[model samples]
Target: MSNLQAKIKTDSWINATWSEYIQITENSDYQKAKFYYNKGKFRIEMSPLGNDHASDHNIITYAINLYAVVKGINLNGKDNCTYRKTGYQDAQPDLSYYIEDTVDAVPYGTSIISLDEFSPPTLVVEIANSSLADDKGEKKNLYEDLQVKEYWIIDVNKLEIIAFAIENEGSHRIRESQVLPKLEIALLEEAIRKTRQTNHSKVGLWLLEQFQK
Candidate 1:
């Protein structure tokens, strides 16, 4: 096994230098992992492949896109995209959105988004199945530091969304999204609950009706 794999465990934070983190992430073994680096610590999340995790992730993405489209809000949605502040921080959120005027902030050919050159996404989301506590705690603080306008954690087991509006290096829990303009956290939770009883196609149709009304 490689030294990186020997010294570090996946799905948990490990103390490492920024350069070591980069090297481990670039190694082929972690090609599909989600990565986070903050405050001299880095976490390599082995991508969750369970059906429950993926189902919730798909529905949330569908709901957001459906809401944005029906509401005529211009947006660019990114799935598992990387955002970096060079040596300072790096995050690969499960889902993120650049909304309204910032929809085009990231140009077409950009690779890992450089936070120093561009503004952070208006919204960031993490789909939590096994990493719920980390998502709600350390990851939440990391997003605040990155100045993400809004952060959300979707708990797959509970079919719930805990959202926060972030500002001035702090955050407060919010029911209605400030970034997405009146998008209701409870509504999304309801949609996720519906998915437990039906397929995503039917849940998506339900979301369409809700967004239209």
Candidate 2:
């Protein structure tokens, strides 16, 4: 392994100081990679996203926005937004949101949201294609520690959503969103499944019908 890879392995968590983690992430070599840090270890996900990953990412983004709009819930969605808790923890979740009363929690012009200044996002989501295990394991723990109100893992292979409602630095499985109110986990899973058999517009129309009820 090169000096960099020796210090930090890609796709797996490794023990490192916060300074070491920052050095690795700042290097130009990993500009496009996703980074996560928690409890003195960090993960570098360098795997290039494939077609399946991209498709699911877009569809889920659409479904959440559509639902929020139809339900008249004030929402702000973040795509691959880096959230940092200074020397302690960091995450760039696939998707995140500030809902209703907290829609403007991070304010405009903020970069690499500082948890010291702003509360962690009310909801965080990771679309898990090849990284299902890590997303379910270490990453889930990371979000729990961050104290996000909700966390979701979309398993592309299974076309399923595994969601949790977080509190008191812990989490438990939940079928409906506590932050977004009546949004159901199974409904989102159904939307993902429909995307496999039809185009997004058709599925979107179906969602509109469902959300309108």
Candidate 3:
């Protein structure tokens, strides 16, 4: 990290000019940090992820993938893909997916996808471990503004999945997923619990049964 980047605050909102935010994102010093910009405020999440966060992230990814495959839903997922709307907004969601009709919307050889040129992800996820508050607050608004159809936050400590269905720039808590259709939130919560005592493969087997139902 350069002295300049070292001076920038991490994991908090900073009043930054649009140009500053863009420059910081392009800097190699903050490559690992998740970046967000909205209403002239910029945030860089530089916290080191722990085991619990990573575990939830992987399990959720696996669950989503398996559900899509079994149910034959057209899905293209991106882990930490950045999307920006020039001077207005930007976000690098922890997990992003283009579902059903938009599965192949983003073409090949694209880097740092521009929201102006392509449709935004239909679903966005944030594995909220230490950043649960921000995930539900500022990040929620961000996803809403991005117009994603659905947003999910996986709470690591509670082993809960909080899902929201976004519409008309507002979000409402939902127990079931609208985008994936018939994918129950409760089943995902159960799968996370089972992983504590069972191997991932066994947990995966259980998940398969759930998805098939």
Candidate 4:
């Protein structure tokens, strides 16, 4: 984080400007933090920074990276962008993946794309430590509307994973082990434990092995 980046991070939300939003959007360092405040062209609402517990955030991020590497999927970990669904909404899933095939299908330099525009991920993961209600409510509705193939919510306090999948045109139904059947629930539990004791890479490697299997 450079001095400028540090300043931007510390700056209050009231001082934010469109130029600052644009600059942060273009820069890689501030992607997650940037999306924390603005949605750019997207109209979706995001929970405030303090809404999510830090520990839960770290665990979810690790799990996503691990799953991506294991599956050879191009997971854009926390790169927030506006997607044009029925309406535009900005979302920063704790982890979101655009498989290699999906990326190859998109035209280069295209920013806003629709759910129909590309292949949906095998799964999308969110950690609900502080934003449990929002994750289960508004965010869930948003993902359903966008027609994401699968969604996972990690409840930090309960130490459980809630997974959902699109069942119909506008409906999403919750399921266990539906998205990544190969991934053992035990492994996710272990990953969450390791994330508390060490870096997320341990969980990442564990998930990579599952994908390799």
**lDDT values, one for every candidate:** 0.92, 0.91, 0.90, 0.56
- Ranking of models by TM-score: 2, 1, 3, 4
Q: Candidate 4's residue-wise lDDT over 45-101, tens digit each? A: 233645335666666666656676666656453334444432233455666655444
Instruction: Score candidate 4 by TM-score against the native.
Output: 0.59
Highest TM-score model number: 2
Model number with the top lDDT: 1
Better of 1 and 3 by TM-score: 1
Candidate 2: Cα lDDT at 93: 99
**Which 10-residue window in model 2 sums to the lowest lDDT?**
1-10
Q: Sorted on lDDT, highest at the top, how do the candidates line up?
A: 1, 2, 3, 4
Name the regions of candidate 4 deviating beyond 4 angstroms. Answer: 1-55, 71-78, 86-90, 100-103, 115-122, 170-176, 199-213
Instruction: Tell me which residue pairs clash in candidate 1.
Output: none
* TM-score of every candidate relative to the true structure: 0.96, 0.96, 0.95, 0.59
Q: Specify the poorest-scoring 10-residue window by lDDT in model 4.
A: 36-45
- What is candidate 4's local distance difference test score? 0.56
lDDT over C-alpha atoms for residue 179 of model 4: 51
